[model samples]
Target: MSGGAQADTAGRHGFTPRARLGLTLIAGGAVANIYYNQPLLGLLVGEFGERAALWVPTASLVGYGLGILGLVPLGDTLSRRSLIIGQTLGLAVALLAAALSPNLACLALSSLVIGILASAAQQAVPFAAELAPDATRGSVVGQVMTGLLTGILLARTASGLVGAQYGWRAVFFAAAVVALGMTGIAAATLPKIPQTRPLRYRALMLSILHLVRSQPVLRRSSLSQGLLFASFNAFWATLALLVEAPPFNLTAAGAGMFGVIGVAGAFVAPLSGRFTDRRGPRPMVVAGALFVVAAFAVLWAGGAWSLIAVGLGVLLIDIGLNAALIANQTRVYALVPSARGRINTVLFTVMFVFGAFGAFAGSQAFLMAGWSGVCAVGILLAGAGFLVNVLEPRGA
Candidate 1:
């Protein structure tokens, strides 16, 4: 069946299959920038020293937090098409800078900007929510999120292969090209929908805080998702390091192939969304958190000894994390139809901030205590997420 057949359009303003495909691609491509450095971290350290390598991943995630806080909310205040185009163009520039960087400092700075502009992915998300009717909103979000999540999981593989063949520099140049193409694609495919509201910048930013304070469901969803995201990032941030130096030593590309395997989890989006539409988001969110805790336990118990365990852990974590995210997003988007953009900003800003910390902690843990330390980090974070969901207020 046509992907369009699933989401019944409401009127002239309803979403089209063409737009859905474009947003999916754009979301995938735009977000991939922040993750490109992961598989290349060893190469980066070889040139820039261990201290310098830490900033590479941490800076990208931190910049993503900044971007989500500063730019994504503008979805309610500016044309999403314009915002996407501007961010994509800027992302292209950032990639070029990373490619041309002469020092670790330069590369890290460029990575930060890449992270900031990658919020374009978040823009594509809320834009999807905006155009989708209530009935099929979960389904459409699920489909579009498939692209975003796939881009994220696949980025490591793409960078690992390109970095292995040409060099890390080549990966950034190729990413720059992708960003440039995405700009053109955004121009051609995205509709010029008007802004939802025109609040001043300060008020717009403040509104996010208000939503966080006022909405119990929003708080629980964002915090729970944030903790899970931290666990997910911790695993990715250290996976290359772990595999590169072990009894089962592997090359960069070998380390990255796990991402392809994890694609199994990314494909769950549409199904999870449909499940939410049928059963509600809460049960799905709980199930997802449980999966994460179990994934970490698997990694801790067997990751250091068995490739099968690590692979299984990867599959479980990705499935659990993305499922929770889709359900959490559906919950928030339903809260305020007009403030979808701002609501998303709060969720993602919290999420990426925790992600940044996870990367930092994971790297440090690996340096201090090896694979065991990294697994411990994931377990603690995932446990916290499980607690948050289980302890959610009776009505909240």
Candidate 2:
């Protein structure tokens, strides 16, 4: 059934197939907004000049980080369906502004707003967790995240294609259209879920700290995922550069196409969720971390080998990164029922911060030691993530 048809019935139980699919689509689109500008950076630079390279990506990421910190916490204190639909409209406006931007500065500012509104995606994630039954929570998160990861990967491809055929601004224009369409779908289909916690915004924000101090599982899960995500970010930050240089000498379009290959990871997400449901989240987490370590090894070696090897490395890293993400999130959401929003805020805040740093670090590493250096850093991070899981406190 379509999301509109099942909205009323699934609104009560949260596990309806159509509802899950709807939430997944929303999550993906929301996340995609933040990434749509990446593949178009060269076009942005060509239009806006060299300064665009320095600030455009940074503005979006900083805005996204701020959005996660400031806006995502509201999930626990507001009507989620209303909040999500409203934010999608906000994102659409921002995308429109970006498309119409007259100068680099204008585009940068609009991109920042785009990032801020994109936190709406984070809301869908925790909502999916909260709505699912305990026995299949892992599976549900996995399915929802498959959409999120798929969006993250595909945003580049879509942007690259649209920007190449039209112009960079057309990417934003297309995104605006999609956001508006999604807003309508969400407004009609998503259940109107009331606040789980009625605390004032200040208190609710402060409570994230208290929850962090108290929950060892939350701490471990956050740390494990943070490290793994950092590794994942590092690989992506330098991937285009690596593929465009030396023997292969591909264009930005070629780099963006890699997103399609990475879809393999998204395909495995639901299967990982099922595995987490059957065995515990910990094993999948371990498996994910180990997959990262192996992926980095392949990447490091592939730096001197063939493009085929590097593509394999990309596929493996995405799979490992997303699998661990689903498992970590499944465990974290289960820690507190009413507090899922705050917990998610904390989790993603840490992950995003680390991911930002990873992008910067990867750039520096690639500049210094090329792809080999990038792979080394990823290996260490992924290995640390695995070790953290191994050393987790018995109860945690």
Candidate 1 residue 166 C-alpha distance from true site, Å: 2.9
Global CA lDDT computed for model 1: 0.87
Regions of model 1 farther than 4 Å from truth: 1-12, 41-52, 102-105, 238-246, 357-377
| TM-score, per-candidate, Cα-based | 0.88, 0.93
Over the stretch 288-381, how does candidate 1's per-residue lDDT look in tens digits? 9889889989988999978899999999998999899999999898887777788998888788778878889889998999899998999899
Local accuracy by lDDT, each model: 0.87, 0.85
Point to the candidate with the largest lDDT: 1
Residue 259 displacement in candidate 1 (angstroms): 2.1
Off by over 4 Å in 2: 1-14
Give one clash count per candidate, in the order shown. Answer: 0, 0
Report the poorest 10 consecutive residues by lDDT, candidate 1: 2-11
